[model samples]
Target: MNPTDLSLDDLDRAEAEIETGKRGMRFDQIGSFEPNAPSFLIQDVLERDSQAGVIGDSGSGKTFAVLSLAACIATGKPFAGHSVAHSGPVLYAAGEGRAGLVRRFHAWAKANGVDPLNVPLYLADRGAGLIDADQIAELRAAVRKVAQLHGVPVILIVDTWARALSGADENSAADAGQAIAVLDELRREYGGMTTLVIHHLGAADKTRGRGSTALKAALDSEFLVARNQSSTILLTATKTKDGPTPAPMAFELEDVFLKTLEDGRKVSSAWARPVEYVAESRPAGKNQSVALEVLKQLYAAQKQTLDGAGFAGREALVLVSDWRQACEAAGLDRRRFSEVKASLVDSGKVFLEGPHALLDADAVSGAASESGGTIVPPGRRTHSAMSEIGVSDAFGHFGQNPKGGR
Candidate 1:
């Protein structure tokens, strides 16, 4: 063949190679690269092959908490008491202000004794909007190139998903679903690396995340960082695929200096509040018996024909309040109160009706007639005399113990 003809064949061969490369092969038994500390006492809230969402209200430190996790991964340190499987370079695509992030990173690195330069942290330049899939893909490719050159895995963080989404109205479920789909795709493409997406919670309650339920449903894990008492940040794991549930973590902000100055330099000092799990806070004192009293009151008020759903709806709160008062009057602990409430509920003495607690009307009327205008104490057996007399005159009677005594 002539030289030019051979060159043409070579070009064809190169094109064929490219096409084959583009068609990636799937691996059957992908090796398990579990971390040395496979399970984190706290971080069990997240696991390998799982996607997680971190959400909070505005100024709730959601970004800071996730950033802390990123820092820990890059430094090979444990994140919120959970050991990471891998650590290396990290990519932080800041959708907000860049200068603010730079300052924050500097302070964090200085406080934690981490060398900012050695951290291998990269920030996307402004105008490179992450909302576009193509832009995100380009960014991921660049990160992979850097990782390959440096010989380390990279964790990608998309701060504030509101800025990373395109073609979706922030308020609509359809739009949010599309945004989340794109994020899932990104995560699938970079299976080896951990991707943390920061989001916001809605005004309703903990279950309602901002934008749509699709955001929460799509994630393998979801965390909420809420501000408590205005000064404390409470980090709660709302959902996790790895385990039952994780204990909440609490943190308090304090000042810290970034560098030491020789010429009258002042190092900012702030309290270092290491992240730790907060023990469950049960209702105390009078509130301990709230559930039980609520159940009892519901049963008493609704009588024999009381429906569980309706009682639960209207009188549940009142029952709870009365129970709390009863607890204070009777001096019962929270655990005991909970047990009593559970027992009463199981016994069917009170029916719960959509937040309302209703008393069995038949039981109440029978007790009233037998006891001669007295409220019937719950779970008391009716007397033989009362059974023989019948409850025909019980309609007007009230305040009778079922045991046949006032």
Candidate 2:
């Protein structure tokens, strides 16, 4: 292509890209530009007006870890030992599992002694549809309402990226980009915004997020949620574009008592605590550890739901088959399940009766297993908290008050 072949329309397009700062930077504007050090919403975790991803294998406690961060940001509490600003409200666009989130948030509020309803956290009514422009607009309207009542939401969280795709092909780069653009648009609205997207890892690879690499490429920071060989849930800061990558944070899943059913059974929710906070009374071998943790996560998320296939009078139960499948899907050996279950059963940590598995709460409770955690319903809440401690101490305190939560 010679200079003569350059059409006027091509020049106009190039000029527009340059003006929008999406492509070329003119030499004249370079002299006036000033570069500043990166600012953070959550120090070292989320840079201002940037997008981040928390991705992991299914049943790896990805949602638990992400909710922790969102809760911290909303309440001005420390996040995994990182500093947080009251910054603004948190807008949670839950694509699925809204019921579970309510229970989990209730447990979290109880643990930290905060009233979840008073926290400046707003939840989207419908699932986030990032692939479609119309849905994005609806989300924007919801945010505006949140801003009017509480404040501008600096923290925007998409519980799972797959649900927000709305039939778009995640494997297709073009389709994926459309979804990424939704967050980008929201981020642009606020200069110090942070978007956290929860996603799943590829089933085969078990390392990277599932679908197009475009999602990974678009993130300013990225975290990998996984269970180490010890069955400890860990949040690894895989990438931080503006700062030095932080060391991996280890977490232990603990159940918070939500409520009791009429049948004399208790319903609980899972909470991710810093390793030191959880008293490890139950001893499990490598294979047994992962298997137990997976089952605990499954049951914790939906403890209120009575499994129809479960044994009569059993409220919190995970099917042995589902646990085995999840373990094998996560790269753990399928044959190891038999030994793992037997070991857990013998150790009295897990009770395998017939077709289902139940974790012995008493065995796991080194200190306090069942706390008087109040169950808070979903939709609206006003709560807040702040602590000058590590992740454990930060969330351990009680008696925080609610502000103007929605």
Per-prediction tally of clashes: 37, 7
Each model's RMSD to truth, in Å?
15.7, 19.3
lDDT of 1 by residue, 209-323 (tens): 5776666667767777766544566676656543444545676666767566899776553332445543333342344235444334333433322223232222212243344
* CA lDDT of every candidate: 0.55, 0.67
Range of the 10 consecutive residues with the lowest summed lDDT in candidate 2: 386-395
TM-score of every prediction relative to native: 0.57, 0.61
lDDT value, candidate 1, whole model? 0.55
In model 2, which runs have C-alpha deviations exceeding 4 angstroms?
1-28, 31-34, 261-265, 276-406
Residue 245 CA displacement from its true place in model 2, Å: 0.5
Q: Which ten residues in a row have the lowest lDDT in candidate 1?
A: 386-395
Which structure among the candidates has the greatest lDDT?
A: 2
* Model 2: how far residue 349 lies from native, Å: 30
